[model samples]
Target: MESYIQISKINDFIFCPRSVYLHTIYDNFHKKSYQRTPQIAGTIAHESIDTGAYSSRKRYLMGKEVYSDELSLCGKIDIYDLQTKTLIERKRKVVKIYDGYKYQLYAQMACMREMGFEIETLKIHSLSDNKSYILDMPNEEEWQKFIDIVERVNNFSVAEAKILADSKKCAQCIYQPLCHPL
Candidate 1:
């Protein structure tokens, strides 16, 4: 049976595979009282972007959900400009483009292409710096990389997944207590 994975899961795996195990297998998340400032800011930014109230630019389709059966991946795109064939992803802060960001966008691009949209460009709008960064569309090699990542995550056993935890990431993770107990 083909395993279905959320695009956000791909990002989580890239961020820290242990996160994937904790979220998908262990079924753990930070408690409701655990306030995440970055997450809260991101939510507000996404809401503004979704409503087309963040910028004065002409609005296109907003928060469109896309899926790819071939890859068994699904996600909601922040914006899609059909006229420019561009996909815009809003970020609360983008001090540096991380692999997780690329992987998430790659999954979205694959789903969009499978849905028959010609994607010419991928852009990340950093709300914090008020800057936009254009990302290169994934090529065949990049697509293969994404596929490999998916396969690795899907094939991991609970024990194998546990090895992906890193102390640095664990230090800042909200699920730290769940991952590491004193």
Candidate 2:
């Protein structure tokens, strides 16, 4: 069986295809004992959002639990609302830096779509300032484009070149040494 996919990994692929390959394909994550402020803050934010004390009828799937065989995609959504039957993907302030979030969100959207869900809405909740932004799904042409992107990711060859771009943020990653060599 293929390993479960994380919706966030889809975004990683979009941000840098090579990064996704390294993280997912090679299973190259290293253990980091140090807890960074951002991760700590994100945990706090997630706690506020995840407790489900605010909303009635809360249902959630995380980590390996969220999956889709048809789309051949899977990922942990921070929170899923069973009441409205929508996917509420949470992001800290940091996600604003990446272009891959769209792909990640779209992958979730695509999976939900495939699961016969009448997704009433797709909201990217920003925990930074406590705000939610609705992502408008594209029209026919754009939908096709997104599908093509998904197909491309699904069919990506092992021979594709891997490039690791330097980022200060890599310091926070346990996989930093493997991804960016000295």
lDDT of 2 by residue, 1-182 (tens): 77445666666556556656666645543323333466567666666545644444336443313567867788655556666766767777745634465566667766766766556766787767778877676678866776676666777665663654556545655345556653
Candidate 2, run of 10 with poorest lDDT: 27-36
TM-score, every prediction: 0.83, 0.70
Whose lDDT is greatest here? 1
lDDT of 1: 0.77
User: How much lDDT does candidate 2 score?
Assistant: 0.61
Model 2 misplaced stretches (Cα beyond 4 Å): 1-5, 25-64, 94-99, 164-175
Over 1-182, each residue of candidate 1 has an lDDT whose tens digit, in order, gives 76677787887787777777776744444434343566666777788766767556664777788998987887788888888998888888889998778888888888999999988989988988899999987778987898999777667666756643357777766555556752
Clashes of each: 0, 3
lDDT of all predictions = 0.77, 0.61
